[model samples]
Target: MNIPKWILDVFYSYLTSELIYFDGEYPIATPVATFFNPTKNSIILSTSVSFYNKVKCIKQNPNVSILYSKHEYSGLSEKPVVLVHGSAKVHEKDFEKNNAYLSKLIEEQKETWKKEVYIKMGRELDSFIGRRLMDWYMLRILIEIIPDGIVCWKKEANILGSVDDLSKTIGSVKGDAVFAFMGEKYPIGIPVKLRKSNRKFLIENPTLNLKEGQKACLLIHSHNKYVKEITLTRYKGRISRISKTSRISRISTREGEIGEIEFIPTSKFSFKQGGILNSIRFILDGKRRAKKFLERYKKT
Candidate 1:
């Protein structure tokens, strides 16, 4: 792989177990759901990876094709991480059964993931999503194809798209998104309310093709516009109002203290509105912003 091992590790470290599938069909997902959260909320793309097709794709359609265009021949393709680029299958009749089986799969995960937590004075998991993932799970899916290839990117390299606007790790996202790409600038998604039974959140006329099985990148934006977030490439969405917590546990069991352990959190934020949004992309420009990010990493 052209990218460094540590850089690869950093990229993988940011991957939250959730899979972000891509497709162009309209959604056949469960209705929208509302989740509660108690924390302030808070995401890039580049081109040194691949210049031609990305520009081509962006110019071709500007939305669906552009996203696919970047993936057509990315610099990340030179890396070692396995890239499973293909389609997934959804078995509606099997959804309930799959959910039941997944419960067992989760129970099995407990053996490996089980860990004690010492919530800060007034913190509880329920305050987030409670125990059950109410909005999703019932929608059944089964990937029928395998990944076409493997890929990666150098976190420290300035080869891909504009590095300036991409956020490192400080974004929170809620709602659905419609994507579009411009020139060499990274592809952008316009956040919209996840559609559900309730019709409350007001969104303008949204564009872009999305479906239940297709994949999309979720960029969680921080309340502070300055700090962006690492991208979460997962299926368009798993559940609504998803709680993505930084589980850096400072355990104080019967023992005095056990220090801190960081655990990747889940997120599926919700909103009472839906539709298009008129908004600015984010952050610095290409060359200068990339220089700024390179400096920040140097200090660390």
Candidate 2:
């Protein structure tokens, strides 16, 4: 499908997108830095070599979906929420070449990079320390997603809040959440209404394609209206039919049953905020993690 220019513009300016890839059992979504590489005619994203799960999944199942939600610090809240389904090509053949490509990409978006650094670290983009302490982030493996389909939600302006809410262990059930599962070739991602009770959550019927035992993932995230605070959380689990009848309406364009499903999340991750000590710990942990990855890279 030919991507509209407006969607391409969102790809360029959007701060972060939820990159959803299928694991062997279920779909998993993670927040990733994105770049619209015009030359490649694809969306380029880099993941740390230490993050083995994401890289491994892309290699196993090339089908992926990227949600460019304007609710985050993307600064384009007025624009429609866009979802892109694409086939991914992992570019880890040459680490140095990948690193250089990412460096140039970052340089082109220097101001945006600085703003994100300030927001996340409460500091300026200090190159010396960054080069020394953040080498793990630089030791990257790139993934390019060639667009196959693009869809948009034009009127989702109310989806903004502090990441603190959705980042909690028991997140706020309000706001928009994306549910993803395998489609024919590309994984399908669509926003669904979220409801929680105890540990298990409920979402209105999203699609008829979902099976009882199929693996799926739900991503709940938003930012404040001012675009300062952001929250992102993901839950991965298998699907089961809900026993009770549901009053929720169907949301997907695909023909499906109008009943609910029980989403028993086996695992979850919340992108939350921390204090100064936590930030220090985060960098130290990254350094330690980088050592292992770098050591393995050398052996290879």
Candidate 3:
């Protein structure tokens, strides 16, 4: 569904006062000069020409996510909080007023930003804007986020903060997934909402010292304080891609490994062919063996 402009307007309002966190190969939490271009239907990230690792990583794998709040959870007041999942595309080139879609957005973005400038910069506001525009024409990189999904809340922040308010909070499903690769383990938090839909999980660079073409096993144990411990085992696959601090590279899309890795959260079943059935069968077979072993030995 096309996002209504009002939602875009709300997101745009936070761009100046609140900051957003960019998570991909690395996690960056910094105040950004950002604008939402209605034409491109995306949020634009502009920075100096010197390529940040993020730029290279986006090119390697476009999957990216961002988080933001009116306050950095610093206060208990309800305010706009958003989580954005999107694809990031990097652009590097000499800037022109009409060089690309970005060039057009820059001119329009400036108009809206100018009013707030005087309020922030005082007497040097004009000079500041001029310098900023000139810098835009210099060598630079742009990261445009085409949002896939968004979660926003304005009044739930305080409720989410308390441990005792365990109504919806306690009811929310969450899990800890551990992935073993390269002789180390990665503990990832899986929200209840994403357990069924999340197929690809990202392990940040240097986290487990992961590299391209490496093999790994993912163990999803979705049992938190609110729910029973359900350990889903044997989600295995080779490293498909890795986002280094410098750049990202693809490892594989479809591999020949059967029962190597699997993601079947519902009913222990998947409809896709090509060894998909074997993994489910394996899981069921493993469960039967474990149940028999428990009944014969540990049941007493």
Query: For this target, which candidate reaches the highest lDDT against the unseen true structure?
Result: 2
- Give a tens-digit lDDT track for model 2, residues 1-300: 456666766776676668888788677777776877776668888887768678888899898888876444545545566777778999987877997786676555534533354344313223677767676666778999887666555643222222121121121122377887766666766666768868888777532456677788989876553334556788888776543345454333323333577778888888653567766776777777778877876898
| CA lDDT, candidate 2, residue 119 | 43
Per-residue lDDT of candidate 3, residues 102-216 (tens digit): 4455446533333243233323423665454333223356777787655444434222211221122211221233333322111111121112226665542212233466554
Give the Cα error of residue 143 in candidate 3, in Å: 1.2
In model 2, the runs with Cα more than 4 Å from the true position are: 72-77, 93-96, 106-126, 155-175, 206-208, 222-232, 242-259
Instruction: Give lDDT per model, in order.
Output: 0.25, 0.66, 0.40
Candidate 3: C-alpha lDDT: 0.40
Candidate 3 local lDDT, residue 8: 56
lDDT of 1 at 188: 31
Ordering by TM-score: 2, 3, 1
Q: Give TM per candidate.
A: 0.26, 0.76, 0.40
RMSD of each candidate relative to the true structure: 22.8, 7.8, 23.2
Each prediction's number of clashing residue pairs:
45, 3, 1
Question: In candidate 3, which residue ranges exceed 4 Å CA deviation?
Answer: 4-6, 17-26, 71-78, 97-115, 118-138, 156-300
User: Residue 122 of model 1: what lDDT?
Assistant: 12
Sort by lDDT, top down from the best? 2, 3, 1
Where does candidate 2 clash, by residue pair?
Answer: 161-223, 163-230, 163-231
